[model samples]
Target: MSATTSARSARLGLRATPEQETVLRRAAEVAHKSLTDFVLDAACRAAEQTLLDQRLFMVSGSQYQALLEMMDRPESENPGLTDLFSRRPAWAKE
Candidate 1:
């Protein structure tokens, strides 16, 4: 079934192991959402990320140059991102 149809349909069924079900329930409770809402939100985010990772991106020569220029630019002076990077765990360092 298409993603939209499957997502909207009320009668669709999914099976999970007891441990998996427990994890899902705990995640739902932590998010302060109903089980259905939690599962749907999580599933949609995962699906979108998977699709974005798998898709091949194509760009015109000008677009490619623009991207290259952006990448080559020095890091932002913004404190929030710099602070976030500076606080990375020791294990995160190469």
Candidate 2:
């Protein structure tokens, strides 16, 4: 279901100065949306962008080729990793 049509049970509250509220209300009016709708739409966009920043990345073509080449390399071991694996995990320790 679309977000607008979905059931909303959670409540979010925030504080803003009177000036801020006035600016927001004016912008919402200019945009032809209710203050609540305007704020919720903007907040959802910001949240989506923040999450996409974590999960998505961009690279140049040359950089992408370099990454592919690195992944194609034969597996090799490091002493540090070997030592780390030899130790007991923190959760397993007394």
Candidate 3:
């Protein structure tokens, strides 16, 4: 989507310590953005990074071939993946 589009916009409420608030305010001023714009941009960037980390993969040709080989292999008979298949705590899951 184009950066100017508001269709993807989401309002978020954040509580920061006074020092953090002051730092953000100063940064917004220096960046020539309104506080809302600065905060939104930062939030968007953080969200993008998080999504990319989970959904994207990068590798060299050899690594890619190794990954393909691993995918083609039959499932392991070991129990090592049991924990991975079970419910995981939020902090530990990802």
Candidate 4:
């Protein structure tokens, strides 16, 4: 974790059955991590995987071709996009 991420201030509470707690504690010991660290790391990994699963997709060959064709198409004029791009981004220094 980065310095910013290391300063965690939120709290999460959970309950597990005795069997589940024992298994988790054993796994934490085997990994040489504190119980909280082990659970947080495992949970973060799981959360990342879950989010990636939602955003990523498999495309058929024809569908992929369609996507490529769309990308290769020329852009149309748009007043909104032109106006939007005219200004500098907020994060950019003058």
Ordered from best to worst lDDT, the candidate numbers read: 4, 2, 1, 3
lDDT of candidates 1 onward, in order: 0.83, 0.88, 0.82, 0.89
Best candidate per lDDT, number?
Answer: 4
Model 1: per-residue Cα lDDT at residue 6: 52
Task: Estimate, for each residue in 1-94, the C-alpha lDDT of model 3 and write its tens digit.
Answer: 1255467465568799999999999999999987877888888789889999999988899999999999999987767677667767678845
TM-score of 3: 0.60
Where does candidate 4 stray beyond 4 Å? 1-6, 59-94
**By the lDDT metric, which is better: model 2 or model 4?**
4
- lDDT by residue (1-94, candidate 2, tens digit) is 1156257667889999999999999999999988878898889889889999999999999999999999999989899999999999989958
Quote model 1's TM-score: 0.49
Candidate 3 Cα errors over 4 Å, as ranges: 1-11, 71-94
- Clash statistics: count for each candidate: 0, 0, 0, 0
Model 1, span 44-70: residue lDDT tens: 789888898789787899999999999
Worst 10 residues of 4 by lDDT: 1-10
> Tens-digit lDDT track for model 4 on 23-90?
99999999998888888889988998899999999899999999999999998899999999998999
For lDDT, candidate 3 versus 4, the one ahead is 4
